[model samples]
Target chain A: MKYKDYYKILGVEKSASADDIKKAYRKLAHKYHPDVSKEADAEAQFKEVGEAYETLKNPEKRAAYDQLGSFQPGQDFRPPPDWGGQFGAGQHFSEDADFSDFLHGLMGGRFSQKHGGATMPIPGEDFEVAARITLEQAASGSEIEIKLSVHEPDAQGFPRRVPCSIKARIAKGATQGQRLRVPGKGGKGLNGGRDGDLYLKIELAPHRLYRVQDHDLYVDLPLAPWEAVLGATVEVPTLSGRVRLKVPPGTQAGQQLRLAHRGLPKPHKGEGDLYAIAQIVVPAKVSERESALYQQLAEGSDFKPRSHFDLEVADEH
Target chain B: MNIEISEAVWLDRAGVISMSELAQLSGLSEAILLQLIEYEVLPPAASAAGGPTFTGDCLVTARMACRLQSDFELDAAGLALVLSLLDRIRGLEAEVRGLQAQAPRRPHKA
Candidate 1:
């Protein structure tokens, strides 16, 4: 699998202000809205753009993505074995509408709440629902089928998706609380009025993979003390998958390794990134040989580990 | 098992009608609009300064006209007359709404 960049899809710079990113997405959404668009791929492109905007617009998810690298769209993406730690029984996004397998493979299958058209239009009859998908889908894009008891406009010229299925292409880089509109799939009209569309409220689920912060992805990359101390090529996990990481020599714990174009793929153009924080783990106790080695290291090195420490004088003047 | 498939005209995203400012999107064509004007059914595109230039509200008008032409078998002249009547009726309805609002508010099925 490959990670996709959310920023590129929305057409913004890595350091683009939040406001700029949002503006870009809104412009694209309006342009690609299926109801008005006549292009062959308008609906798909609109959804893709929306998803990309969703990811980059959020500060938390964006940050988590930044850890992997500069996100690219459609690049081979795969998360490491320990990507999400454990994808247990928990639904994050709603995929009430039908989505694509590409999205499923990329996102790891998140489902969203499906909604339908409004009826009983004396007034105030509105329909609303939600969808839950994984962070992967937000980054890589997917297709989903939202099954709702909708009234599709038939040849007779009435409202219709009734008992209809709307196929939604969940864009890569979609963020939590993002709302997408499935035109003509909204609430029923009043007195033969136009049907209100389906509004999708996006919600993200928590995973053990990494903590998201804006466009950067942060994951605790476990490293042996020796590996951290001596530069080594470590197999680090990203949202896309695992890649050989270069740990600089004498690397300290909590140091982050940045790999470009390795984060969430963008819907269209820009990329999000990922970060790997080197976390060193040690056993509670070491064998005698290990202890002797440490002792030798202590004897040979004059470097004071706590030299920066300051102690209060016994008698303060 | 082998299967038989049929082909049909697929209209998906529609198309883009880029204007100097906002793009007018639609699946219909300019010829349709010309026919509409020739019949004198609806108003022409008025590009008020700092407003949508080419065709803004024309999308809805065009859709209605297209539906009338394709489904009702209404020729361009017939559509123009019918749509003109419909627009007049709509105006009357709006005036009625205004008058009703002055009288009282009631929960009525439109």
Candidate 2:
């Protein structure tokens, strides 16, 4: 196994006091905490720091580790033959099996047990991964196949990921960042311990025609210039199916028309409402006859555009 | 490599874990768990004859509490206070996410 330099991991000297070690560990723990840190490898770094602290915090373990003398980190080295026997004199170390194989070899079997001759029970570490799904899948519950990296022990008891896939059921209306738990699918257990859980955080993919707001769904309902001026029946697409919507007379752009109980499904309550937003569009190129008709209508109409702007200018003057 | 799919139980969604199961899963001793319960660090989902029954979330809390207590040597009351604050922080974060999701979307560029 590769040798680990606990002092370097903790940023402490070999002659550093336990109090100094504790302070250094505290600083690193806060800096690399998974919940608060933004660093890319914060979780891994935090585990390494924890492992280093676990060994150095105890005087017996520290003394025993110091006896091996200085060796570069990642250098292949083996512990003394009777190194594991020394664990009987050290403090009880109850932690997850996140330490490196070097530390494991140093402590040996004695560190793997607890109490009066009973094996220590250390549950596996939990794993979390984000899974992206489409809006249709969110609207109608679907089964999704996802990959998870599960840890398994080698012949020497070192942890390594064995890529595995499982079909997960995503319930309808699964919100963004909602956790779907699949228990006993995490890192491997130690000493015949139970496995940890796997949590899948839901991420909804962006839709071309729809935007989600909680359970409410929003879609831009495009209309022609003439249609916006005069009311017309329009077909709107919803999650379930297409439905005819009545466009009120003098419908303005950027207006939202609500369709009740047509949005995403709720686990406990009725479905939310869907809003169809109005968007007016004009043809880019017009024929000569169409241009002439538009010119005639513009000349005949007495509608003054931005009349309120004139009033505002008068008020300012 | 030979790939395999493992069966998984929904810890937070489906199962109601007993005290012993929680203790084993969280790697916490019964005595420490009792102290934590007394201090309200870990709350149970249901009460029973053996003890308070917990779900997966409680098991998570227990693990966190145990690790923090070991590292910082925090008393039961202090751990409970910290845990309560952490819970409040998590709730606020979820609330923020909900509000952001409900915000109006910008129109797509033509």
**In TM-score terms, which candidate is top?**
2
For residues B1-110, what per-residue lDDT tens digits would candidate 2 score against the true structure?
44444433334533477889777766678877888888776777789998878866676577677767776677777777877887888788767765554444564433
TM-score of chain A of each: 0.52, 0.71
Alpha-carbon deviation at A119 in model 2, angstroms: 4.7
Distance (Å) between predicted and true CA of B72, model 1? 46
Any runs in candidate 2 off by more than 4 Å, and if so which? Answer: A1-5, A64-99, A108-134, A137-173, A186-195, A205-317, B1-73
Q: Estimate the TM-score for candidate 1.
A: 0.42
Q: What is the per-residue lDDT of model 1 for residues B1-110, given as tens digits with 9 covering 90 to 100?
A: 32222111111122222233121122245565666666765344553654323433444455556545643445777778867876787677656643432231221221
Clashes of 1: 115
| Candidate 2 per-residue C-alpha lDDT over A1-317 given as tens digits, one digit per residue, 9 for 90 to 100 | 56789999999888899899999999998788665466899988997898888889877777878877778997766655565456542332223333363354335422243222456766677776777988888778777777775555544443434677766676676655555666676665666877777667778898887777667787888788678788999999998899999988788888888999998886445787888888877777889998999999899989887899999999999
* Model 2: pairs clashing at backbone N, Cα or C within 3 Å: none
At residue A314, give the lDDT of candidate 2: 100
Q: Give model 2's DockQ, 2 decimals.
A: 0.24
Best by lDDT: 2
